[model samples]
Target: MMLIDTSVLISMFRDQTGRVAERLSALVGDGDLYLTRFTQMELLQGCRDEAEWLRLDSYLEGQTYIEATDLTWAEAARIYFDLRRKGLRVRSVIDCYIAQLALENQMTLIHNDRDFEVIAKLRRYRQTTLDTVRSTDFHENDQDAIL
Candidate 1:
């Protein structure tokens, strides 16, 4: 399973070379793709207007949705505390939640944000950046090496 993060979605919209589309296409039509509610909030918050929000919201409605429970929140806090103990800090609290949520659910997080890099280092959750995806032929079997 894979959790699609907001950064990658933005990359898909802003990149003109079609590399993002090519890589993401490799995962489409599979039943394994997913996104978190936190991601949905982040995406919706970035919309320019209600129309855009409605369009994006409708599109997101078709995705596999992952809901975070109270356990997810607790574990996210614990992960942040542990990272702080190690002198590492993820800039986004929501990124921390997303990472821990993915870990809790056994999902590999596909993201473009540097925040995930920081989160992954401290937690060992699977993740690959948009930069990595854009530069390679992404395959399910070779996921570990994609980033």
Candidate 2:
């Protein structure tokens, strides 16, 4: 399974080449998508207006949401301190939560944020950037056409 971060979701909502959106849709289509409660909160907070918030609420209404327990928060705190000691500062608590969720769940993370790169490198969790997913889609499409 893949845990999606809020950065990718926000980017997908903003950009319309349908790049990140398509990638997320592909994951959902393949039944490989999972979402954490932290991600839901972050995405909801990202909306600037009531209309956008309502839209997001409606969009997420039927989706599965994973809850982070006390264990997850404790682990995230450890990850935050560890990264801070390494001179890699994560800008938000939400980032740490997302990283910890991916680590504990053993799920590959799909994100467009650089913060996850540092966390992935340190924590040894699998991660893929938006560009990586896009290029992968391109390659897959090329192979399909050839076949």
Candidate 3:
């Protein structure tokens, strides 16, 4: 499984030719896309208006959602402190939680955030590269792209 991050979701929602959106299309075709509550909350928190909120909510409803266990929170705390001890501070505790969720589930994170790069270096979780789709010949009828 591949965990979807809020950064990727936001980019996908705003841009159709970006790395995150294109990667999402491919991953969805492979049946490897996934999402956690952490990402869902983060995405919902960024909605600018009711229309966007409903749109995001509807899109998320079609996704497979996962929950982080208590043990995952414990690991997240441990990771936060460990990074702090090494003089690395992630911008948000939610990022730590999401990273731990991906680690515990052994899923490759599909993200556009660089903070995950810091966490990945220490935690050793798998990640997939996202490259922008620069061509103009994108498939308009693709369900994944529409999502």
Q: Per-prediction TM-score, please? A: 0.82, 0.79, 0.81
Stretches of candidate 2 above 4 Å error? 26-29, 132-147
Model 1 agreement with the true structure over 1-147: per-residue lDDT tens digits: 888987777667656787887787676546488888876777776777778778888888988888888798988888888888999967767788989888989888888777778887888887776676554332212212111
Best-matching candidate per TM-score: 1
Q: Residues 16-134, candidate 3, lDDT per residue (tens digit)?
A: 55665666787657766778887677677666677877888888899898787879888888888899999887777677888888888888887766678888767888876453532
Ranking by lDDT: 1, 3, 2
1 against 2, candidate with superior TM-score: 1
In terms of lDDT, the best-performing candidate is 1
Between candidates 2 and 3, the TM-score winner: 3
- Taking all chains together, the TM-score of candidate 1 against the true structure is 0.82
Rate residue 85 of model 3 by lDDT.
92
RMSD of each: 7.5, 8.7, 6.7
Q: What digit string (tens of lDDT, one per residue) describes model 2 on residues 1-147? A: 788776666667666576767777775567567787766666676566778778888877867766787899888888888988888876776778888887888888888777777787678887777765442222101212110
Segments in model 3 whose C-alpha atoms lie over 4 Å from true places: 16-19, 131-147
Candidate 1 regions with alpha-carbon error over 4 angstroms: 27-31, 133-147
Clashing pairs in 2: none
